[model samples]
Structure formats: C-alpha cells, structure tokens
Target: MLNGPLLVTERLILRPPAAEDFDAFAAMCTEEETMRFIGGACSRSAAWRQWCTLAGAWHIRGFSMFSVIERSTGEWVGRLGPWEPDGWPAPEVGYGVRASFAGKGYAFEGAVAACDFAIEFLKWPQLMHCIDPANTRSQALAKRLGAANAGATRLPPPFETAPVDAWTQSADQWRQKRKEF
Candidate 1:
C-alpha cells in the first residue's frame, strides 16, 4: 500500500510495490537462476513475507526496492532499486530482472534511475552493490554503471556466510558518470 514517486525511464517504470505486483514477484522469487545470488528461491508464502518486507520498508525507511514495470506491455519486469535494511554494509542500488526479461537492459535502465533517486533525492553520499562472488553478470553490470570493486565483505546474519564483493562509487562520481550517459 505504499505510493511513492514513479521513476520513468525510456522503456520502464519504477514504482513502489502494490498488491497486484505480488504474483509476478512471487514467481520471480521461485526462479532458481534469478534468485540464486539473491538469497535463493523460496515458497510463495515466503515470497509474501519478503514482498511485505519491501513494501513496509518504504513506510518505515522512506525508500525501498521498486517493482519494475515494462512501459509498453505493463508487465511486471522485476524489482530493482535502493535497498538498505538493518545491518547492511552500505546504502545499495540493487537489481533483479525476471528471467524472461533478461538481456533487455531493463536492469541497467532501472538502476540508473534508482541511483539518481538515491544520490539526488535520498541524498546518500555513496552507493554500493553487494554482488556475490559468482555473479559475473551483475559484476559486469556494476562495472558498466561506473562502480568499482571495493573488495570483499560479509553481510549481516542470515547472509553472513554469503560471499559478497562490494562495488562502490561516490555521489560525485555517479553524477559525473550519469552526465556521460
């Protein structure tokens, strides 16, 4: 039930999650490959709780990952945006696009908008992308977004054992890189 500003890109719309976005969100959660680096696949009930967590974050923290939507077809593409739950290493602009929408650049497009929202609106001084060691695709994307590998770091509990590499860039760096796009 969170209604926040919609971040419109050329081919996608990033907005707060709604009740209608759940089924697709849950389906994405069940996709093993898609959820591999993102805490693994889960049951529909677990997805519900996870979805609620993201939705509730906006009300409590004033920001959360956005439910990505395709502009032309209005399909739920995936969820991607700012996320920094308790004990997180840093403010992050993370992303996950549905398997069907893979390679379409929706993640990159949405991430750019999300970074802008985070650095400009949310006023975060820096941004990080906590990518898993084996997630090469995300590493490439983070590189393409002008973030550099800042070395390894363990996440907080539940994910404390997860091997993660921190990719980061400063707000000034983001603004300069954004202008080049």
Candidate 2:
C-alpha cells in the first residue's frame, strides 16, 4: 500500500521481508530461545504462515516488522520495527534477533533505526513495547531506550491472558532521548 525507506544501521540493513527471507525467518521462529517470550517455538509450516502474515501486514496495514539483514553477509538476521495489530494497546516498536546474532547489540542498533522510522514516517504520537514480564533482556532494552513501564496490557486473541508489561513514552520523550535512538 505504501513504499517506505529502507533503513541502514552500522552493520545491518533493515528492509521489508520477502519470500527469499523465509528460511532465515523460519529458522529463528522455530528456535526455542528466540520464541521464548513470544509464544513457544512454532513448526516450520506454522512459521511459514506466520512469516506470510507479517508480509501480508505490510500490504494491508502499510507497516509491520522489517527483515533485519547483515550488511556484509546479506543474510536475514531477524525482524524488527513497528507493529500494531488490531486491539493492540498502542503503537509499538518490537524486535527479535537471531540466536547467533543475539548479544551483538544489533537489536538495540536496529531498534534505534526502526524507532526513528516509526516516529518520522509513521508519526505515531507515542511509542510502546509490549514486553513479556519475564523477559529481562527486553526489560533492560526498554529501559535503555528510555521507555518506562506504562503498566500491564492484554494482548489480542490466543495470548490475551498472558501478562504483558507495557513500556511507553511520548514522541517528545523519545525526541529528548533521541540522541541514542
């Protein structure tokens, strides 16, 4: 529905996911560790459907996660960017890096670039991250990004009952903390 800019970080390329990215996306989604907080690991077939849904979101909503790629290797590393499904509590900037790529600070780096896009193009007055309460790593990232816990929220459908903590801040807040984002 819309053509947005592709983002380039220090060592990564953030672009919309395509069929060619399925293998990498599937591998990550099927990994237990990667799927830890966002529902359990999914089967390859299930992952395919999920991957398709992500791509479809871009067409339908004009926005969704972008496939993160390694600049030097040209490999899909993960998906990260803005996501707000129906019934979502608020506009959110979400991310997930492949296990092998985890710990390299790519998530943070990618998120900064993604949040920049979300604020600039999406023009969301505010931003939020619906993080799992037990996901300490994400909690740390949220804090680092300058989003305070806005409180709990219920996700839509299947996982609605799960405990999700809302981390949010106004665009002005993000602008003040924009030095790093």
Candidate 3:
C-alpha cells in the first residue's frame, strides 16, 4: 500500500477514502448539481465502482484521489487527486467539490497540493486538468494552478462521453508558478 501522512492544507484534509465515506460519496455522485458536468447522476453501484477504482490506483499507481474533508467539520467535502482515464497521455489531477462547497477555495487548495505532490514526490514531468469548456470555475482553477489552456479533446476511450478542453502544466512549470501564488 502506498501510505503517507494525511495531506494537509490550510482549510482541508486530503486523506484516503474510508469505507464509511461511501454515503457522503454516493450522495455527492448522485446529486444533480454535483454531477452536472460529470455526465449526470451516477447510480450507487457506479459510485462504488468509482471508489474501488480509486483504491486500486493507490495500490497500482502509488497515488490516488483523497476524500477532501473540511477541517472545521471534518465533513467529506469532495475529492482531489490524480486519475488516468482509459487512454489519456498522462494521469490528470482531477477534483470535484460538493454543491455546497463549490464556491469555496477548496478546489484550488486541494488541486495545488496534489500538483505539488506529483512534482515533489512522484517526479511526474507534467500534470493536466481536463474540464468542459462551460465549466469556467474549473478552468479558472486550472489557471490559478498555472496550467495553460491546451484546447478541446476527447476524454480518452471508454470514459469519453463529451469533448473537453485540456489544461496542462509541467512539473518545472508548476514549480515556477507556485512560487508566484
């Protein structure tokens, strides 16, 4: 198992998903608002499959999405980490916040931390954030993390449901850019 200390940020805690988190996760996955850009609400079984995939990533790839928690309530606020869609060029740092948490800086904080981990620990050469063109919130977050717009592309095979614009940043680029934040 790829174990490490809980990833902590000023207002968030990024930790492995626990079995008990299924409820919160499932709720988020099923919420219309939360799944708006995720191809609509997923079934409970689909949510479980997603959880298993994240766990598999920890064992197979050494890093996976963390259940984002708010420090104040220790609530499962959303998810943040890297994921490799069926045939993508690289693992992309992805995030999804609950509807209630959407306007907060949690997305920015969690994503930047994940990017830093990939740069400082994983030694990944580059990181990407794929978002639908209509999701200005995520696009802005990518820019905040120093990812430059790479234009629209398919979401790799299997996971391909809609076209998306890709935002990319190299480890070297992130290092330089984070300092400016």
Candidate 4:
C-alpha cells in the first residue's frame, strides 16, 4: 500500500484525500462550473464515489490526486497530483481546484508539487493532461506547464465522445521548463 506523503508548496499542502475532506469534495463536485471541464455536477452520492475512487487509486496504482489544502486556512481547496488508471492513455499530473479557489494559482502551485512528486516518487517518464478542448482555462494552464497537445485520445464512456486533447511533456522537458516555475 502507498502511504500518502505531505507535499509542501509555497501556499498549499498536497496530501492524500482523507475522510474529512468529503464535505469539501462534495461541494466542489456538486458545482456545475467546477465540474464543467470534467464531468458535469453530480449527486452527493456520486461525489462520494468519486472521492473514494481517488483515495483508492493511491493503493491501486501507488499514485492519485492529492487533496490540495491551503496551508494558511487549512481548507481542502482542490485535488492535484499523479493519476493513471487502467485504460488511461498516459500517466498524468492532474489538477482541479474548487470554484472559490480558482484564480488564486492554487491549481498551478499544487500541480507543481504534484509534478515534483510524480517525477521523484512515481518515477513517471512523461506526464499528460487529458483536457477538454473547450476548457480554455485548462488549455492555458497546460500551456503554462509546457505541455503541448500531442494528439487526440478518447476517454472512457460516457465521456468517450467528448473532445479530449492529449497535452504532454517529457521528464526532460519538465526538468528544463520547470525552472521558470
């Protein structure tokens, strides 16, 4: 089993999701805008299942999204980290911040932490962001991270039909590009 580690960034703590984070997770997952890029807003029960799945991914694959906690307020602001499950096109350092947490650079900072963890701990050779084509914010973020749209790939159904872009960067590219961050 993989023990979650605390990843300290300048303004956030990237740690594994815990039982107590369910409420925050629920709030985020239930918001239409917050989930617009991923799946649409879902029921509370559905959110719980998603939360549990993220937590379970750590044990299953030795890596999963870290619950991004604001170090100052100690609130669970988002989820960001390494993610790769069966059927995924590639290993990814993904990030999703709550609606209120958006525009504060939490996603960027947390993703940087997660990327560091993915490279150092998970030892992935490359990383990808399975992004929706219409999500301009995510597109900008991916570009900022030096990830370019490498190709097209389908997500698992019912999202299979959604326009998914494969944004990617090699380990060496990250090492070179990360210097700017």
Best by lDDT: 1
Residue-by-residue lDDT tens digits, candidate 1, 40-129: 999999999999999999989999999999999999999989999899999899999999999999999999999999999999999899
Model 2 residue 25 lDDT? 87
The regions of model 2 sitting more than 4 angstroms off are 1-4
| Model 3, span 4-74: residue lDDT tens | 44889999988877777788888899899778776568999999998888877777777888889999998
Total clashing pairs for each candidate: 0, 0, 0, 0
* Candidate achieving the largest TM-score: 1
**Model 3 lDDT on a 0 to 1 scale:** 0.83
Question: For model 2, how does the per-residue alpha-carbon lDDT over 1-181 read when each residue is reduced to its tens digit?
Answer: 2245588888999888878899998899878988898777998999988888788888888999999999999988899899988888887899898899999898998988888898888999988999998999999988888899988988988889889999998889988998854
Q: What is the Cα-based lDDT of residue 139 in candidate 3?
A: 86
lDDT, each prediction: 0.95, 0.87, 0.83, 0.87
Model 4 misplaced regions, further than 4 Å: none
TM-score of each: 0.98, 0.95, 0.92, 0.96
**lDDT tens string, model 4, 11-78?**
88888889988999999998899899878899999999899999999888777999989999999898
lDDT of 2 at 93: 96
* Global fold similarity of model 4 (TM-score): 0.96
